[model samples]
Target: MADSSPSLDPVELGAYFDLIEVTSLLRHAVEQQLREAGELSYVQFQLLARLGDAPSGSHRMTDLADGVVYSRSGLTYQAGLLEKAGLVIRTPSPDDERSTTVTITEAGRERLAAVLPGHIEVVKGLLFEPLSRDDVTALAGLLAPVREHMRATPPRSAAPRRRGKVS
Candidate 1:
């Protein structure tokens, strides 16, 4: 009988696992920091941060969905939560009758300000503290292609959320 199990090269598997482990740790730390700083979930923080950085203090909900790589319905839920918090406003997109735009409110900006320092410190401590400057640069270069490759396919989250579970 022929052995038919698929095998990845050990070095490739190690690299893949290392990336996953590091990002998992980083994500949990940042999520906790964001929750503590502003009572924001990670997705809410991402949405607010994106809105805060827009040149005109607003962005299309579609664009925000893409920026955060989150499902449109999920982003909508986050937006609603933020709006209820007085942290953001959602209005019809003036440029598109069918689209919505989200703008950061004063409270949103305040929340972002509250979140930034801790976010920066947490990221720096977790992601950069162990790396040399050259390692940082090299890591960015290595990840760029992988990110672009994944982005080319625009994952399912790029679309609206499914209404029901599959049978």
Candidate 2:
């Protein structure tokens, strides 16, 4: 029997490989810059950046885990480390009894501020340098729908955890 799986044509295959390589390169550079500038791991920086950007300066931990595409337990551990560093505060959510909220503290903002310049430089050099304004716009236009399609399903973190063996 023939294998029954969809396959990419050469153009699509090349595009997929190029996208993966570029993202990996960009992430590595960004991680290095974040570590050097603020002593933050990539996930910690993402959490702080999200909190800092929120108008209310906070979000429920579940929302954070989904937004960052990180596992819930991993997010919890990272939040705990930030709490110990006095960079963020975790509190019981006023709006949701079962949910915990995380807020970026002043120190978190300072740390984010300290890292923004280097982060921007790294991103610019690695990701945006070769792209023209039109290329950047086209890239976003192309990827936005794909991103939306992927996000149409609930994030993995939003799924209920299985407790028993499957049949």
Candidate 3:
């Protein structure tokens, strides 16, 4: 192995490790709860939640991909699955013929309704139980800047896709 100096200080390393472990554990539990309650994947639930929250009850496929921070191809595939299940409908966007719009159906809303209680419970039990209100406020305050900094770099989904064949 090539030798390299350790860059992170012990405090930084501990914080990073703690963040990773907590997110991993939280995601695992959330995924299980989503599957058991609504038969949805974490990504699918995110998509539905976004659609449900949209004023128009719909969003462009590209926007959804960006909003969810998912790959374009993966978002397309997940949308297809949701379409097959009759939980969402994908239509050619009225604003842009080349783009698709995904809208949650009534069934999708119902599925979310079924899942939310369990989802909230899981989040509360695993992520919030140990934290006091002040702790949570401090955590959010501490993490917001980090999240913003990471987001300063454009997400892959924000880039223009090459259409057809590249010369």
The CA root-mean-square deviation of candidate 1, after full C-alpha superposition on the true structure, stands at: 2.6
> Quick one: ranking by lDDT, best first?
2, 3, 1
In order of listing, the candidates' clash counts read: 0, 0, 0
Query: Per-residue CA lDDT of candidate 2, range 1-167, in tens?
Result: 99789999999999999999999989998999999999999999999999999998899999999999999899999999999999999999998888999999999999999999999999988888999999999999999999999999988866889889988
The residue-by-residue lDDT of candidate 3 on 92-158, one tens digit each, is: 9998998999999999999988999999999999988999999999999999999899889887776
User: Which pairs in model 2 have colliding backbones?
Assistant: none
Task: List runs of model 1 lying over 4 Å from the truth.
Answer: 1-6, 155-167
TM-scores for all predictions: 0.89, 0.95, 0.92
Poorest stretch of ten by lDDT in candidate 2:
154-163
In order, candidate lDDTs are 0.91, 0.94, 0.93
How far is each candidate from the true structure, as Cα RMSD in Å?
Answer: 2.6, 1.5, 2.8
lDDT of 1 at 77: 91
In terms of lDDT, model 1 sits at 0.91
Which portions of model 3 show Cα errors greater than 4 Å?
Answer: 1-6, 160-167
Task: Report the lDDT tens digits of candidate 1 across residue range 81-118.
Answer: 99999999999999898899999999899999999999
What TM-score does structure 1 among the candidates reach? 0.89
Least lDDT summed over 10 consecutive residues: which range in candidate 1? 154-163
